[model samples]
Target chain A: EPEVTQTPSHQVTQMGQEVILRCVPISNHLYFYWYRQILGQKVEFLVSFYNNEISEKSEIFDDQFSVERPDGSNFTLKIRSTKLEDSAMYFCASSIMMGDPYFGPGTRLTVT
Target chain B: SQQGEEDPQALSIQEGENATMNCSYKTSINNLQWYRQNSGRGLVHLILIRSNEREKHSGRLRVTLDTSKKSSSLLITASRAADTASYFCATDNGSGYSTLTFGKGTMLLVSP
Candidate 1:
């Protein structure tokens, strides 16, 4: 079965540095989303994209965060400046017209 | 308040046994989904129960949704050691391209 795939399975960056987490969603899926989970916390919604634009976002998705589908298959999350608390597992998911979303293996972002 | 909150944060069982996890949400939801995550890995889509549906099953996994009560349960029968993982419940509003709200998840350990 086709699945969402993410690059740089593990990323380590210095605090205040910019970082980009990339994902290649299933080719046919239309809706894309980004979520994050702290080491021992709930998965928090960051943003959702559809029709090549952001459809919804959470409070945590502040100015520091931005998402782009630079190409047909690539969906990326960019963090302008990383903070210690920004360290977490970031997941990319995609679905077919509000259907069940398939999540990627996730990118573990560690900011020190 | 969180949208989805799972109870019995941790559970332990042996192979061939059954495991049940429960989730409660604070508001109306269009659908409820269950996901499994291996230690430090990705979220695997398990099942989804819609607001109009009361029960759904896939393989040995059974899920029931009580829309009136705003609760859902996931049951894994005749489980194996490979079933050991953290299970999460995510809620989605019916709006188009909406984001998912995820719970803290339940950690299940199935010993061989």
Candidate 2:
């Protein structure tokens, strides 16, 4: 069972600093997505990527957020400037046929 | 705007008992997916039912979708303590992409 993998299981950063969360989706998957869970809140969609461009994004994915598939295997989400509200558990997911999506363990981002 | 909303925010059951969680969505969707998330972890894909399909099953998990009513239910049979987690329903609103909007999850605690 190949699964999505994310780096830096947990991260702590300053409020004004930049943070880049990295994910390596399943090798053969064509669609990739990023979602966030704010502590006890529901998981929220951030962005979706396919064919090397963003397919969709949520309001939470504002000016500070950007996603890129810098290479064949890596999908990165960069926050230009972090805020306290940006602290959450970020998950990366991928699907092969737009059916069941497989998720990674997630990266917990903590901004202080 | 939240696309999905799950009912009965929390549930507790015995190991041998069955657990049922219901999900309701606000709009038409191409597919509905159920996911399980252990505390402090990312979501694990459970099952997916297309709008055209009424029911689906995998192992002890059964998922039913009623597109006309815009609702879905997830049933876990013969539960175990390991089944204690949060279950969420996500919907892809026929956007022709993989961006999923998720609802607040139902927390299940199965005591052994």
Top-lDDT candidate index: 1
* DockQ metric for all predictions: 0.83, 0.80
**Residue by residue across A32-109, what tens digits does model 1's lDDT show?**
999999999988989999999999998999999999999798999999999999999999999988868899999999
Candidate 1 CAPRI level? high
The local distance difference test score of model 1 is: 0.93
- Looking at model 1, the pairs that clash are none
Model 2: residues >4 Å from true position, as ranges?
Answer: none
Model 1 alpha-carbon miss at residue A43, Å: 0.7
Per-residue error (Å), model 1, residue B33: 0.4
Worst 10 residues of 2 chain B by lDDT: B92-101
Prediction 1 TM-score vs. true? 0.97
Q: Which ten residues in a row have the lowest lDDT in candidate 1 chain A?
A: A93-102
Task: Report how large a share of the reference interface contacts model 2 reproduces.
Answer: 0.82
